[model samples]
Target: MKLFNSLLLVLIIVLNFMFAEPSLADPPKITKSPDYVEVTKSLDILQGQLAATKSGQARSETLSAEDLQKKIDELSFQKYALEKGINWGQCRNETDKTIAVYGPKPKKPKTPYDNTLYFLGAGQATPTNWDCQGIYLPNDTKLTSLNTDPNQQLEGAIAIKIFKGTQLIAKNDPETGALELNISPSKFFKSGEINWYIPNVSERNIAFRVPDVPLGGEEETD
Candidate 1:
């Protein structure tokens, strides 16, 4: 009985410390950096579906063979883009609703200080202080919005400064650790699941299909 109680007490203490808020002095790394792993797995499944379609073993109610191939091509490109990595940048809410994001901690789930909770307003963009290389938002990822007035800003809210052209970043292979080519990820975050960008991407090669627009802190870029 004494041994059981002692172990229970120790377990509780460890749990508390693990969930404790982190300090800036020892900023956390992105333990689950949005590497689009799940999305990739989904793509693999889609590939099987495609193969099944060709084999006449399966068929979609709405999509044709051409449609499936196009989708595969598009998703494959998004995978390629993220695997290359992105720059530490900002996230622009192209959404009409406000969104509160935690880190890719979404460490890069990203984390949020009690007040560090960033609420991205509709149609507005917020710059990140993240050092992540990629970000992804799953389909089931629910988003929220907060109502606030510009005149009634938060106490320690920092001034909004738009960044310049996207920085060129290299994408590396996870298994080989070999450096591939580089790219500038897009900074737009809008509706749809399967998202992965922002905090570290520019040039909008995303699973969520949004147009590529200049982030406007540096010279205009594609």
Candidate 2:
């Protein structure tokens, strides 16, 4: 009877240890699925193909633009899936609509600006609010004319003048033929223009207008 009781106590202790929760040091190992490996290999191949196509060295006899575009679209979808943490098996079968609903969105393309003066927001000159607005002059370009609206008075002075609603905020006179102004857009107010007098033999001038809100458009204010 004593022997039986000792064996029973031992069995209870073993059972308790077995049923206890695991310690932090004994965490389950994470293993990648076969599908994940296969998908990753496929993605690498697709990337290589894209590179070859771009470098004009595609193996195919004739790769049309349409075909190249289709490949790009497919790659984009797969990339979206991978970013969203979708399993490889599920991603492979996902429809465009399903992917759109669950996967990450593609980023918008960046706008390309050239040696021209234009408004900054919405990629159009639609008289946006002038909280912080200014012109972007490329390197080696010259400023032409500076003026304020409600009074088309040109700042004839051969100096840089920044204003906020007719009140001069800042001024400078670099006097260099090539100038680039990257000042904070907040210094100048709406309906203001800057003229750069290119110090060449021609003395040519270029004009840029500050963006303004509607009902206070450039023409109305000028």
Candidate 3:
């Protein structure tokens, strides 16, 4: 009876060990499919062919029938990939609407005499409000008969002069009678003043005056 009991105990141990050992037959491995490998190789070959074409080495005549078939197969696979992407909601939306991305408005160019030059002639006639005023030029000459008529006024022509130090630069001769004055760039003048003289005290001359705000619009003399 004891012998039979020992044998039974040994058999139970053996059965437990057998059951504990891992199964020799494995579960299906997570592996890439054969089709996937073929597709990957096809893509590599396609890229090579394209490179060859770019390098001027690929020719339709040179390619074997098998090579052309391989290229066609790769194209078909790519098309399938695209189709799959669309069906799986992996494709992105295409938008062609142009958004006018406006940057900060470009800044305006600045002028030299933006607020420095003034009209002095109209002060005599209009008192506070002046028209055809004498603008002091840096060249030591006064401008008289300065007109603001849009059609006749000398636009951009220097009509008077203001001088510093000894007026080493001779002032313009109005007695020469306001000849077609060609204003030149002056090195002596602090800020290139156009010079002319007013013979009459009652009326002020409007020399080409720099605007208080000179950069953009025309200056208005009251």
- Highest TM-score scorer: 1
lDDT of model number 3? 0.33
Model 1 segments more than 4 A misplaced: 1-34, 87-90, 94-99, 102-117, 128-222
Q: Report lDDT (CA) for all predictions.
A: 0.41, 0.33, 0.33
Q: Which stretches of candidate 3 lie above 4 Å from their native place?
A: 1-31, 60-222
Query: Can you tell me which runs of candidate 2 are displaced by over 4 Å?
Result: 1-31, 62-66, 86-222
Clashes of 3: 22
Indicate whether candidate 1 or candidate 3 has the larger TM-score: 1
Per-candidate TM equals: 0.36, 0.22, 0.18
Q: Write the residue-wise lDDT of candidate 3 on 37-151 in tens digits.
A: 4455666776677667656787556566466566657456544553342211110101111100001112333333322233322111112211221233322223333322212
Query: Cα RMSDs of all predictions?
Result: 18.3, 22.4, 34.1
Clashes of each: 25, 9, 22
How well is each residue in 131-160 modelled by candidate 1, as lDDT tens digits?
222223333222121112212312221112
Candidate 2, residues 64-143: lDDT per residue as tens digits? Answer: 54565565565455445444543211111111111000111112222232111222222222223222122322222233
